[model samples]
Target: MEHSGFLRRWGTLSSFFLVLLLAWGRLYAQTPSTHWSDEDRISSQVIKLRNGITLNYAVQGDPNGPVIVMLHGAGDSWHSFARVLPLLPANYCVYAITLRGHGLSDHPARGYSRADFAGDILEFLDQLHIQHATLVGHSLGSFVAQKVAEQDTGHLDRLVLVGSGPGTHKAGSSEDEVTSPFAKLTDPIPYTFARDFQASTIYHPVPAWFFEMMVGEAQRVPAATWHGLGASISAGDPLEDLKKIKVPTLLLWGEKDSIFHREDQEVLLKNISHASLKAYPETGHALHWERPERFTSDLLAFIHSNGPNP
Candidate 1:
């Protein structure tokens, strides 16, 4: 009887392992290879900082053209701009940086603060010998961009902050707000959960393949990243930082963005002297993903505008 029970337990465990393997294989098969051919898909390399930390970044378009550095939000990688890349003119050089502790970058045990992330951007520009460039940031990235512009006004040509607000911290009680939607992901997050989370957040329908590719890239981010960086943002007061944005700034938000609402935009407009806003109807936090064409057009127009002859 003991020998029979042992055999039964082993057989059940083996069946479970086999089922998991098959499910993984099926999901992998569904994911496409188009990510490799994406116009924004430049092979990434590491930029070593003075402190020995390394940031992974992708560069595309003409080297001599106007530089535009894009920063992605928390729980996301630089691939957030994949669809927007091909839409821009070929003459514009675009650099996308994966913040430390996120994406393929080194994950240090510390240094997930907004100031730390902002400092990385400045150092990254210095290492690349880019004296100044138009800074574009989305969500958490937008908050970082504000800090960069404030660090030195002369180093910024223009600023674009999307799906961002005046304050860095969450509006409610700290204890209850510390959790993230991605808290459930395991160390090596399963692609299915990532896909479901991506689909659930957006108010509009996106192409299935696109969402798959996005979640695949996002899943590569370490689980610690979400908590570390999130805690940093939610613990600070950022109204002072918002006031420091002196460059001509463009604030873009989606009508259906649940994270940062219209009230947040109003607060930002009140704080920043040179800021203006435009809203995308029927869009959510993933405005760039939902309305790529409009995002590209509006961004280009803002970048090209002389802004009252300076």
Candidate 2:
């Protein structure tokens, strides 16, 4: 009886070990391959900078095609361009970056200035060994894009500024729509704060899922980001910078955008000699979010219309 009992116990242990081994094998098989394309990859990458700060970003589309970099506004992540990523031409390689202090990127206590952000972008490109490429920036990202173009025009081919223009905002002024919406943002910011800000500012009605997604992204941002980025905008003067942008420029605005009014676009149009304005009717501050299909199509058309020579 003792011998029989020992045999049963040993058999059970052997079976358990075999099951675990099989499971491990399955998991190993399911792991992503090192040769995966950028389009198939997600923005889970962390890049360490010379300053010891880390930035996060994702890439999509053909690896050899013309590069088009997308930079999101404040309080956003690389996911901001998720909707337009797959819609881009297959012949183009797209890069979406989540600036430091936002998204999965490291949140340093300082270095959130617009110029700092632009420097980070330049370094990002340098690290990747990317030469001239088109730049598309939205809102606050537009400010950073313009800064990069002004500082080094050779790094960019064509520039697209969405919901942005010369910074006419008075420093520390609360009368401006964009600054006013986020003026009261406090540390450990709540999801509700982001929801309320988006609801009050976005001209078109965004779906519930989009609102939730945006709020989720905003909630990840640290309190320092809000204060630091805000101070950067307050201290920045982009009017002169816009005038110096020599690249072919496209300015996209929404007719109903409350944050950036018609007057702002007018000033932008007048200041940038090579810039052209395309206003979307019945749209809001988030024009791309309001009509992503149209936004993607227009972007492709513009980029291809004046694409660099092959």
TM-scores, all models, native as reference: 0.81, 0.82
Query: Which is the leading candidate under lDDT?
Result: 2
lDDT of 2 by residue, 1-310 (tens): 9999999999999999999999998887764332234236444576887777788888866778888898998888887776677667767777888999999888988888888898889888888877668899998888989888888746788889998867656754432545554546777788787777666547777666666777888888888888787677777584776788888889999998777778887888888778888899999877877878889988877877886542
| Candidate 1, superposed: residue stretches over 4 Å from native | 1-43, 170-186, 190-193, 307-310
lDDT of 1 by residue, 215-245 (tens): 8876776777766765776576558767877
- Candidate 1 positional error at 89, Å: 0.9
What lDDT would candidate 2 get against the real structure?
Answer: 0.79
The TM-score, computed over Cα atoms with residue i paired to residue i, of candidate 2 is 0.82
Candidate 1 has an lDDT of: 0.78
RMSD of 2: 7.5
The list of candidate 2 runs beyond 4 A from truth reads 1-43, 171-177, 180-184
- Positional deviation of residue 251's Cα in model 2 after best superposition, in angstroms: 0.3
